[model samples]
Target: MTILAELPTPAPTRAAAPVARPSFAARIRRAAPPYLYLAPALVLLVVWTYRPLAQAVRLSFHTWNLLPTSPITEVGLANYERLLSTPDLGASVWRTVLMVLGILPFSLVIPVVVGLVAARVRGRIYQAMIFAPMLVAPVAAAAVWQWLLDPGAGAVNRVLGVRANWLHDTDLALLTIIVVTGWHIVGFAVLVVSAGLSGINPDYADAAAMDGASRGRITRWITLPLLSPTMAFLVLMTVLLSAQWTFPLIDTLTQGGPSDATTNIYYLLWDYGFHSYDAGLGAAAGVIFFVGFGLIAVGVVALSDRVSHHDD
Candidate 1:
């Protein structure tokens, strides 16, 4: 045993062989696939989104009529100054805020209630029915609503027994548009909320039930906390896109009037760009909206991160 220990311990064992470093080309070859996989998406994003955004920014500095023959002349901040001083700008922005507020109940609040109740439903037919409105094309839906809300010989007036011009009256037009837009898009919100509901683990609810918690308590506590992320997402989407969602309907039904009562920022931008042929004004408004919305998005995202609760 002494001799075995005294043999210099097998020359103190050679240090482990140093691992051969991969060559630079080998390292690059290993990294290439991920970037290669990402290239198509990156290229398309740059071409479609960023490129147009850059063009819009550049166009905002120049006056143009959107004609090829019309030379673009740089007017610096003239477009912005005109836009800020325009009374319509303030009115349009206020209408946009109203649209967002009106859309919130349909997109977030009611959808959450519907989603929670829908979990008890045992058939796909009811689910399909609930989601059917979202499948209808916006133009087609607008056409149907136009017929239904006609000032004369309309079903809505016939039922209510009043010749109220729902779409043409300045007092009722915006509210009517809001309701129609909500009906058109609420199904999509319900679908998203239902999906979020299905994703929640049942164990928490079951445990709560075993602890003598009522259905209302379970929903208010376990279910809603888990659904907060989806609710936040819906709120964010409604705030950002309510005006856009109403744009097509407004164009089809009201054309932003009975005195521009239904004209949100989106319709105003379209009117400036296409109807009035004021490309620089439209671009300036677009840039302002893009920056403003970008800031709002950042704030909403930060708030959502703080408030949203993940089950895991």
Candidate 2:
């Protein structure tokens, strides 16, 4: 057996398969078109948005009266330092804070409840009636409210049997802004919240009801958790937009006065850049406003996403 089997054992050798490498040109060809397609928008963003931003930043470091012929003096951080030192700045900031607080209760919270109730209504007629406010232009809406709040002859005064100047007194002036401004902006929140409510699964409600959950219990324990994302989004928006919202009304009705009580950041920036012609300080304030607001908006979004996911 040994002699036959061991006669000759020949070893077989195999060549290694060639490595399959993709060509660099082929890879680049596949990736290049997407960037090429994006180039136009990329160029446009830099030209239109970023270019202005860059100019604003550059101007913020210099003292200019917004006159083209004015000498540009680099005062380092003096403009920012001055804004911080300004006595009225904190009050103006606080007023902005007040607006945020005052607006959110009526704007986001009340409308959410209304939207939920409206959703339970059988027909679109009631829904449309409630939502009609959203269709009105902000300026037009402000005008309508201005007429309604006219202290001498307006509907509110007539109904309440009280004759008081609504927009003249500093205390009442900001209040009027809150009410009037709420009218136009609240509608948007209502619509968004309503849409969010409608998207929630009805099965959750049914399940809660089956377990003998009261309406309040269902809403508190079941519905609200599910509605968290929408509510968060609405609140976030309400916070960010609260400052700039009174612009048209404040401009038209009060002009940031009865004693600067309504002079928010928007009004301040306008006053600085346009009214006072201090473009450098205004530009710095713009940067501050943008940065401050950007952080808040980011925080709102992040915290919302976190809370919503945690609920899930």
Candidate 3:
């Protein structure tokens, strides 16, 4: 009886149960909420960003003076060709590079150092003081700086005991613009860096310290590696936005004066569109800039992904 029980035996035949699947309407009901939740943002993006981008792209192929009564003449690649052949384009591009390099120390390097220290400090006053400059409107800041940097009666000249034309001199105008732009945006950069620093896990530094690591070593190996993501972001912002940050200041103060010393690509594009009334040229330039910067942004993001160390 034991041997027979241990052996395989035939069982009664039974039908397999049908697997239950949700109806199409039920599936639609489940998926609708996420798309519904996303709809407003999607609509705004299309209306504001994508629509303008598409219009710019369309306008790039046509020549127009931006007058409502004037007809747009389709010029194919003429606008782009003319823009590229212009000597001013090359000079403006070089100046833009200088701006990016000059702004890096203020926006990326100083902010990282200040933010690291600021993260440990306990005071709203210190934070406010560091971030105060960013709160001032760009136009207001430009006006204030114009007075301070005036060649003859300016406080800066008086303090230095020398009358140097800060805005009128071609050599100094670009540098002055860079400095002013840096001052305006450095506070915002510091705040962003401080926020990033706060998100870092301090246990890594503490553990390194416990292991007989020196302060510098702990910071270099533990803290900095963790802070790489923030630094990369700052670098990206500084590179891409250096011109934009200086635009209002340049527009108000220099007006791209002193032989176009302070003119960058952003200002150049604006000059073409508004000052020269060459809408087609401006549109082409804008499209080129958008494409070029988009590529740079992609590269930066890819590099950051490789270099940045996340806690997770």
RMSD of each: 11.6, 13.9, 12.0
Instruction: Give the per-residue lDDT of model 3 (tens digit) for 1-312.
Output: 111114566995756634787788986986698799999999999999999889899999999998999999999999889989998888998999999999999998898888777666786788788789998999999999999988887899999998999998998999999999999998888887887888888888888888899988987888888888788888888887888899999999999989899889999988987888888888899999999899988887788779988879
Measured against the true structure, the TM-scores of the candidates, in listed sequence, are 0.86, 0.85, 0.85
Off by over 4 Å in 3: 1-44, 119-123
Best TM-score among the predictions, by candidate number? 1
How are the candidates ranked when ordered by lDDT, highest leading? Answer: 1, 3, 2
Highest lDDT against the true fold, candidate:
1
Cα deviation at 208, candidate 2, in Å, is 2.4
Error of 1 at 160 (Å): 1.6
C-alpha lDDT of all candidate models, in order: 0.88, 0.80, 0.87
Compose the digit string of candidate 1's lDDT tens values, residues 142-235: 9999898886877898999899988889999999999999998888898889888888999999999999999999999899999988888888
Better of 1 and 3 by TM-score: 1
Candidate 3 overall lDDT versus native: 0.87
Q: Report how far off residue 273 is in candidate 2 (Å).
A: 1.3
